[model samples]
Structures are given as C-alpha cells and as structure tokens.
Target chain A: MAKVPSELRYSKEHEWVKLEGATAVMGITDYAQAELGDVVYLNLPPKGTALVQSHKMGEIESVKAVSDLFAPVSGVVAEVNQAAIDSPELVNKDPFGGGWLVKATGIEPGELANLLTAAAYESFLEGLATSGH
Target chain B: MFLTPLNPLHRAAGARMVRFAGWEMPLQYTGILDEHRSVRRGAGIFDVSHMGRLEITGPQALDLLQSLCPTDVAALEDGQGQYTVLCHLTGGILDDCVVYRQGEGRFLLVCNASNRPKLISWIAGWQRRFPGACLIDRTEALGMLAVQGPAAPGLVAEALGTGLLALPRFHLGQGLFQGDPVLAARTGYTGEDGFEVMPAAAQAPALWRALTERGAAPCGLGARDTLRLEAALLLYGNDIDESRDPFSAGLGRLVNLDKGAFLGREPLARTKARGPAERLVGLRMVGREVARHAYPILESGHRVGAVTSGSYAPWLECNIALGYVEARLAEAGTVLQVDVRGRLAEAVVVPRPFYRRSAASGEAAPREPRAASAGA
Candidate 1:
C-alpha cells in the first residue's frame, strides 16, 4: 500500500503538502513516484516566484514520460530543494523526505481545507489502480 | 492481447508489465537503469517473443527471399543470417528483418511486431508470384529470448553444454536445453556479445527458470530501449518507417544495387546517385540534460532536423541521441544544438555505436573472479 501520512495533505495531481506554520513543503506522493519510474530530471521554478493554485510550477521527466508539477496552493516559492535538483533520483528514493521539490511561504491558510486527507487520497489511488491507468 | 511465454516468469521476478505492440510485456523488472547496467557490465536476459517469426520453405524459398529483400539473400550460406529490409516498389521500406537460412530452401524472417500483419500480406503476395513456395507465420510456435552482455557467451555455453567459440557472428545452429531443441544464434539488437535463443513455447518457462537460476538477470523493454539507443541501433517506428528511405536512416550499406532487379531497386538506385537530403548521425550532448525525440536540431537559429531517439547513456555517463540532420551538418565533428524543452543543449556529431566493447577483437579480457565466490 502507498504511504499517506495523516499530517500531510494531498492534491489531485498526486503532490503532498505538509504545512509548517505559514510555509508549505511539497513533494510527490509514493504512488506518483512509483508510476513515474526513475525520475531523471526535475525542473523547479525559481525561488521567490509567485505561483497560483493549480498552476504548473515545474516539470518532472522520468524514463517513461514528462509530467508537469502543479502547485496545490497559491504562494511565493521561498526556497527550492537544491538537493533534489542535484540528484533527481532522490525523488524516487525518498519522495516524502529530502526529495521535497519546494517550500512555499505566505500561502493562503484556508487552502489546506480543500486538499484531500490521507484516507481520501488512499481511496483515490485505489480507484486508479483498479482502472488500470 | 499477446503475451510472451515467460510472462509468468517476469511477474515472478517483480517486473512491471506494460502493453507494447499488442503484447503484455514487462517494461522493467527491478528498474531500467539497473537492468541496463547489468547488460553492459554483467549479463541480462530479455523475453522478446513478441517479435514476429515467419518461416519460408519449398524449392523456391531462396529465390522468393532474394526477390523480396534488398540484401543479397542467396549469398547467405546455411546457418547464416543477414540484416535486410523488405521494401515496396517505390523504394519505401516495408519492414527491416533478420533473415536466417536454416537449410536449403528454408529460411526464417524475424520482424518487428507492429509490421507483422503488413509483412505477412507482402510475403503472401510474393509467394503468389512463386507458386511452389510456402510461407508460415510461426510467431505463435516459438519463444524468443535474448541473452546479452560481455559475460553472455560463457553463461550460454555453460547452459547448452557446448563451446560456441567456433561459431562466427550472424550464424545460427541447433542446440539442446534439457533434451529440447533450441535455435541459438549470435545476434541481437543491443550492441553486445550475445545470442538470441528460440525454443519451443512449451519449454520456454523451464528455459527462463534455468537461465535466471544461472545468474542471467531478467530485463525488459525499458532497458532494451536504452541499450539499443546506446548502440545507435534504429527503432522501427521511431527512427525509420515506410516514408523514410534506407539512405536517410543511415542504412545504405544494407542496400545492394548490383544484385539485380528487386522491389525498390530502381528508386533506391536513383536516390543513391542524388544523395538523401537528410542523413542519420549520432549526437553527444554538451550538458547533462537529455534531448528527447522530436527535439529540433538547430544550426545557429535554423532548424536543420529533429531528434529520432535520445537518452542518458548509462554506460557512456552522458546524454546521447540519434537524429537526422541536413547533409552538410551530418559530418562527424560538426557542432550543433538540440532544443531540449525550450532550452538549447549543445551537441557534437560523433560516429555510431557510442559504446564499443573490445570483445570483437577476439582477445578476451581475463574473467573477473565470480561474485558468489568472492563473498563466500
């Protein structure tokens, strides 16, 4: 089963966001990384760049295909994960930990309520698995 | 959906299954990078049963093949194979295939899976011209497996209980695996010292088990792609198709005009003198980022051509690709730029086979001590 921690919120695009005070740490879910297979390159948006909710922040190229990374909430990109950029395979190695893509500060606090909870995201992945996508 | 005889074996090895050319095949077992490195540094086995197999028999088989293929089929002695392309009347490639002469008036044509139906119809048309010949689609009857890498020969020799050192490249012969007939040939799409084994479908599971037990790591289509790309081998649908001529795909050597009248000979002869506008060349990226297929190859600001295949060559530790550039830009030392995701990645034209092993020189490197013994 894919790990979905209760403290983290999920996006429909399979990104997980952990809220720490006013800042939100973002990383792809376990289910997302499994589907992507061997993340080769991660194109991250520049720090201090303002991103709107549901807007593409960057791109991730795996061996199979390239996928656009969408922002779950509107906020300023305070910091980008330089570690993940240097070793993109870290996303495949540890998607929930050091492989986090970005840290966004000054995000709307109300956006967290709209994101899916751990149980909801798990069920969503279940549907995808059965449908053979 | 089509499935290889070793589908269950792949599942047992934890391979990720994916649909490819109508076949439910493994896309990767452990991972593409790991499998690719195993094939380069050690050994790897692939279930390639999805490749179409057609057998031609009868007194006029050789004559029919000679008429159908662009290469000189009659010159291929028994137990020998040659890479050739079947073409249409207008010099368009029908399918690129490996023709193996098993016996007098008997040959096997191994073709790409997607071209099976089209090639079958074309062969049927040729068979009608030669009334005495017979063509049989034996794709369902045979299970194909490719064992590749530097250590492949030793493992294969140990498995078959025979020394294949005497057998030259592109030659096929009959062997036995646990008393079952096996067609073992020293040929593969990956640029490595390897053999493709065709065994009866019933025995495929056992053969796969034995090979895996003998330390041949299971690989899949994902690794197969990277390996072929590193070798600069052409993938049919991506690199060349019916619309592309042999010269444009850098396959001019496979076409022989002196052999006389055959399908596409006239147009090929005409194109040979005039030269193709676009030519295939190897591109080495100046940076770490990979330039994927359909990425534009530009000289200054002008788009010269497009990338046909590209990947981060794990063996070479750099990004390499194959692309068709303008005839002037196809030179070995020409510097170019590949538009990779809106960013221009610098590239330099290089000779084919970005990774070449010295095993072809017949001077074998001293074998490393077996890993199992070292740990024990």
Candidate 2:
C-alpha cells in the first residue's frame, strides 16, 4: 500500500500538495515513485517561475520511463529542491519527505477544491491498481 | 496474462513485473542498477525461457542450415555454437540467431521471441529445397536460464556438480542435475563469463530455485539490456532489425563469402565490394548525463546519424551507446554531439565493448569508467 498523508491534497497525476497560508508545498506521492522505479534524473522548474494548475512543470526520468510532473495548484514557484537534483534516488527512497519537488506562494484559494483529499486519492489508486497498469 | 516459470519466485522477491515480448517478466527485483551491478561484480541468473528454440535434425540438416545462414555451419564441430544472421535475398537481416551443432545431423537454433513466427515461415518456405529434413519447434518443451558474471562458472559447477571451467567459450556439454538432463552452454548475451542452461520444462522451477539457493542472484530483462550494451552485443530488435544489413551493423566478420552460395549471398557480395554508407559506432559521453535511443547524432549542427541503443554503462561508470553514423564519422576519437532531450551533449566516438577484459590474465583492463546510468 502507498502512503497518503491526511494533511496534503493530491492531483490525479500523483503529486501531493500541502497548503501553508498562501504558500503550498509540493512533491510526488508515494505511489508515483513506486511506479516510476529508481529515478535517475530530475528536471525541476526554476525558482521564482510561475506555474499554472494542471500544466507540466518539469519531468522526472526513472529507469523504466520518464514522467511529466504536473502542477496541482497554480502559484509562483518559491523554491526548488536542490537536494533532489543532486540525488534523484532520494525521490524513490522517500517521495513525501526529502523528495519534495517544489514550493509555491500566492496560490488562489479556489484551487484547493480541485485537488483530491487523502481518502479520495487512496480510492483512486485502488481503481488504478485493480484495473491493471 | 503472461507468466514465466519463476513468476512466483519473482513476486516473493518483490520484483516489478512488466510485459515484454508477450511474457510477464520481471523488470527489476531490488532495482535495475543494483541487479545490474550484481551481474557485473558477482553473479546473476536470468529467466530467458521466453526465447524461441528450434531443433533441426536429419542427414540434410547441415546442408539445409548452410544454405540458410550466412556463416560457415559446416566448419562447426559437435558441441559448438556460432552466432549468425539469416538474411533475405536483398541482404536485409531477417533474424540474428545462434546455431548449436549438438551432433552429426542435429542442431539447435535459438531466435528472438518476437521474430519466432516470421523465422518459422521463412524456414518452412525453404524446406521444399531440402527434402529429408526435420524442423521441430522446441520452445515449449525447453526452458533456458542464464547464469552470468565473474562468479558464474563456480555457481554453475556447483549447481550441476561438474567441472565446466574446462569448456572453452562457445562450447556445449550435457550434464545431469538431480537426475535430470541439463544442457550447459558457455554462451551468453552479457559480455561476462557465463553459461546458459537449458532444461526440460517440467524441471525449470525446481532448477531455478536450486540455483537461487546456491547464491545466483535473480535478475530480469532490464539488467540484461545494460549488460549486453556494455559488452557491445547487439539486441536484435533495438540494435539490428529487418531494415538493416549485416555489413552496416559492424557484423561483417559473421558473413563468409568463401563458403559459397547461401541466402542473400548476391547482395552481400555486392555490398561488400561497395562499402556501406553507414556503419555502427560506439559513443562515449563527455559528462554524466545519458543520451537515449533515437537521439540524433550531429556533426557541426548537421544530423550525421541516429542512436539505436544508448544507456549509462553500469560497469564502465559512464554513458555509452551504439548507433549508426556516416562511414566517415565512424572512426574512433571523432568528436560529435548527441542531442539529449533539447540540448546538445558532447560525445566522442570510441571502440565497441566499452568494458574490456584480459582473457589471458582474467582481469579487467584499466580504462576511465564513464559516469552515467542506464534505463531499464
């Protein structure tokens, strides 16, 4: 089973988001890393760049395949994880902790409604797992 | 829907299964890099039962095979195997296969999984020319497992309770393990010193378990690709295919012109006289990042060739690849750029088999290891 933190919101693409006032912390979900398999390279968005919700922010290349990281909420990019860039395998080791991709500030309040809660995302993953990837 | 004899074993070991060539084979057990390194430094066993096998027997078998393959099959002694390509009349490669001459009038032809149907049709079409030959498809009756690495010989010897170290490369022998027949051949796709074991289908799972218990690490198709790439061995579909000629793929040594008339002899002779326009070359990156398949090779901002197989070599510690380039640029030490993703990455042409081993000394030679990683 994949880890789903109750405090965070998730996108269908498997990115997790944590809101702190107007800023939101973002990273890949545990399920995403398990599916990607041994991340080798990470192309993260530059700090201070603005991103739109549901748009591709960057890409993460794993041993099996390369996946595009989608933005779950719209905001200006506040910080990008430099550590993840140095060691991409950390993403596979801990997708929710040190493997966080980016942080964004100045998000619209209505964007939270578009993201899925922990229970809903867990059910969504169950459907994907049973449906056979 | 597809499964190997070791499917349960793979699941127990936490392997990630993926569909490859109609088989649900493990893509990775621990991880691609870890599994790859285990094969390089120690030992690894691969469940290659998915590869198709055919047995051609009878007095006319040698003559039939000699007429089909481009290699000199008549020169092969009993218990020896030779890698050859079956080509069309136009000189295009039909399939690359290994022929094992088990005895007089007996032979085993191993082919790629995807091309089994096409090869069967091609061979059947030519059967009328040789009236008294028997071609039997033994893919379902046999299961193959490859034990590869520096420690392969010891592990295999322990498993079969026989001294296989005396067997020279490309030689085959029959042995008994637990009262079952096992065909052990010193043939492997990985550049390492290894052996491929062929056993009856009913005995596959037990043999696999025994080998695992005897210290042979379980590996999947993912590591198999990286290991073969490091050794400069060509993968049929990815490296060489129907559209490519043997001469253009740097497989000129396998073609024998003096052996007389065979399939695709006319075009091969002509192509030999007039050198191929493009030839296969090895590429070494200037940095850590990798250049994947289909990446364009450029010389002075112009497309010179395209990459067919590219990966980060685990043993070499660098990013390397095999690709087709204009004959002029195929020379070693030629500086070029590979368009990786959207940016041009600096690369240089190098000799094939990026990893070299001294056969006489049984030690790896000194070379600067490249710093890149391969994809599964």
Candidate 3:
C-alpha cells in the first residue's frame, strides 16, 4: 500500500529523487515516513551546503526517536524546503509531494545508475517485508 | 514474547503490537502522541497486564516487606500504598515497586515487567528468613488496566460505581464488575489521577470493552512510556538498575534508614551521612536535536555524564531527558552540551518531571515549555 510514483528514482536508504534536467528534487520515501511514526523536527543543511552521495546530510526526529538523513546524490545544495522545516508533520502526511526535503543542481546525471527506478524500489520493499522488517 | 490476557482484544482494536520486556503488548492503538495527549488532557485506558503483580500474606507479611524495601512499609496502614524501591546489600537498586497494604495481613507489590522474574527470586531468598510469610505470583492470574487522565475518576465511577471513586490518591478499594469483585487502587505511572484495577484474567476482555465504551481511549505502551517520562517517573531498566542505588538515582527521599535493618539499610545510612557523588537531573534540549541513551554529556569538551532516557514530550511539546551528572553540576540552570551523534547540541540542567497535572496532586512542572528558551 506504500506509494511509489513511477517518475522518481529511490535510494536504498529510503530517499527519493526526481531529476528535472540538471536539477534534482529529494525527499524521504513513503516507507521511511511510515516507519518514523510522527515527524516532529528536522535538521537539514542550509542552502549552498555541499552534499556527497550516500553521505549523512542531517537528522530527522520523530516523537519516538531520531534518524540520520542520507543524501541520494552528490551536488551543491541550492535550497532547503522551508515549508517542510516549518511543519514537520507534512512529511508524515505527504512524503512524496510537499514533504520534499531538498532541491539541488549540478549533480552528474550518471548518479541515476546508483539509484533504483520505481519498479526496482518496489521489489526491494517487498523483499524487506518478506524478511520481516 | 509473552502475551497479555487482552492480547486478542488489542489486536482486534487494530493496535500495533511490539515486544517490550518479553511481552508483546500494544505500542499504539492510533498514535503515541495522540494517546499521550489524551491522558494528559482527558482520559486514556492502558492494558498493563504485562506488569508483574505479586501478593504476600501471613502474620509476618509486613515484617518481610519492611526488611526487603527501603521505604517505611510498616507505616502503611490498610488500603494504603507507597512508591518504594527494592535494593541490594550494597545499596544498589533491584527494582522499583508500589507496595499496597490491601488487608490486615496481606500486601500487594506491583513491579516492572522486566524485573518480575528477578524480583520473584529476590523476594524468595528473603522469604526464607520470614518463616510465616508466603509469596504468590498473581501476574498471570489477574489482568491489570490503568484508567488515567483528568476525567478518569468520573469514568471509573460511572463504570464501576462510587466505591473506587471514594478512594483518595494512593489508596485501594473494592468494586464490582458483573457481580464479581475487582480490586481498584488509586495509583498510576502516568502522573495522572487514575485507578489501576485488577480483575480476573477471564474478565479482562469485558473490563477492557466496558472502559473503552465509556470513553477511555485504548492506549498502548508507546504513550504510556512517554507519559511516565514526562512525569519523570523512572523506568526500571532504562533509568534505575542493579548498578545504581536509590540515593544516586534521586530516590533518597523514599529511603527510611532509621526504620530498621532493611536490605540496604547499612549502606544507605552511610550514604545518607555522605551525599551521593552523582545525582540524577533533568535535561532540556535547546533545539530539535535529541540526546539518546549512552550519548555523552559534555562540560566544555570533556565527558561529564550520559543520557539515560530521552524523547520528545508530546504533551509538553518539547524535548526532555534524564541523566546523571556530578553533584556539583546537578543544579538547575547549569548549561551543558550533549554529543548527539558527534554533533554538540546545547542542553541545560532543568527540574525533573517535565510535565505535571491536577490528577496527581502536584503543581504544574516548572520546567522549560519551549526548546527555544532552554538555552537561556
């Protein structure tokens, strides 16, 4: 029942990325949001900060616990989503849309090779469920 | 994992079950924040049958309890209960318990689920000296439910009648449910005015149904934990354990050394003369960062202490934590830092019980209400 829009590519760490030309939009996936329960706070890098592929960028905290946020691609941060920062529950409500965490540009297009397409991500989720995650 | 008597009922209510202290109990029915706020603002019912319930009876029951617990159990008249701790010979804590004097020669001890097995063996060892006393594990035979919040007393009164409503806080009384007697005690871990009721295991489903129908939200362990933390009630394994003593854990007020030769009396008396070197203090995060367990507490750049328990207090809407620090640094207003996953997050020593309510006969907790002002 987890939403996986076919247009976006996903990271194994549960981050999703949508490439529009040289620009990329990123946010946590539906599976990650459901696992996090209620999102309460966030600590993402400010604009102009550099990000490394698969590296920890910041933290996401819920009422229950805290988790590290990993970057899906190597790029210079262009803008951090101000709306999601103001109201974290938006991530729990809409992980794919208004909950987008970052917008960055200048990433190599070949980064898609390291990310999974919608079809691949769905199977990965299914594998996790069968293994009792 | 072990199952409570109401396991099936919890599943039927769509509660998300999780393993805690060897039992598969509901982590949440709807959500932890929702359930936590319900108990703080109104009423919530929790199926706490997984917690241990032990009964002791005999002419020497009082004598045995007095020798085992640090609290002055001899002073508890019938129908009264006191929050106390079981300690080791070296003054280390064994477990925290609420000892209730339910009858002339009978007593009931409620303990944490994780410490149940250890407590049974510990009490048995002490029972050998009290020849006339007997210990019975009633945890499996009875089902326990905690109905808590501001409206709890009214809900309980309506469902079970005026018998339990008439009892004051920390008192016990008897009431009828379907013509069967159930013991109701005015005690709870959530710092809310409420009653913890003990019914026959077979009647658990009916009791749960009746309470929920009467407007008590079916809560789970997740909210129960958050509520107790906001009240600053120590979790046995997470906060206090065999390695820490009551004095160091900020429970010295419950120790009555002059009462007589209890389990930790000798060492506790010595500790009373010379204050504990480390004291448990409350910590308020200055921002969104959380200081989880084992995270180092820093004074300047050196490690001073570590967090025991930390989380976002839903009702209070702030991040709070409990940790042990040097006696000199335990005072409120002392600023410190927590190494939250390698990043230094500013924190300050604040007063305990991050939240309080009228249900427990306490003033509103005078702690940081907002993380923004915690730094100053």
Give the poorly placed runs of model 1, Cα more than 4 Å off.
B360-376
Candidate with the greatest lDDT versus the true structure = 3
DockQ-better candidate, 1 vs 2: 1
Worst 10 residues of 2 chain B by lDDT: B367-376
lDDT, candidate 1, B1-376, per-residue tens: 9988888888877788999889999999888888899998878999999999999999999889989988999898888899999988988788888998988888999999989999999989878889878999999889998989887777776786454544567777666689766888878877888788888988888887787788989999999999999899889988888888899889999899998778899999998999998999999998877888899999998899999999878778788999999998899999999998889889999999898877553224234322111000
Q: Could you give the interface RMSD of candidate 3 in angstroms?
A: 1.1
Q: How do the predictions measure up, each by TM-score?
A: 0.95, 0.94, 0.94
Q: Which one wins by lDDT: 1 or 2?
A: 1
Please report the candidate that would top TM-score against the real structure. 1
Local distance difference test values of all predictions, in order: 0.86, 0.85, 0.87
Interface RMSD of each: 1.5, 1.9, 1.1
RMSD of 1: 4.7
Ranking by DockQ: 3, 1, 2
DockQ of each: 0.58, 0.51, 0.66
- A1-133 in candidate 1: lDDT tens per residue? 7788888899999999998888999989988998888888888999999988888999998876688999988899999999999998999989999899999998997988888999999999999889987
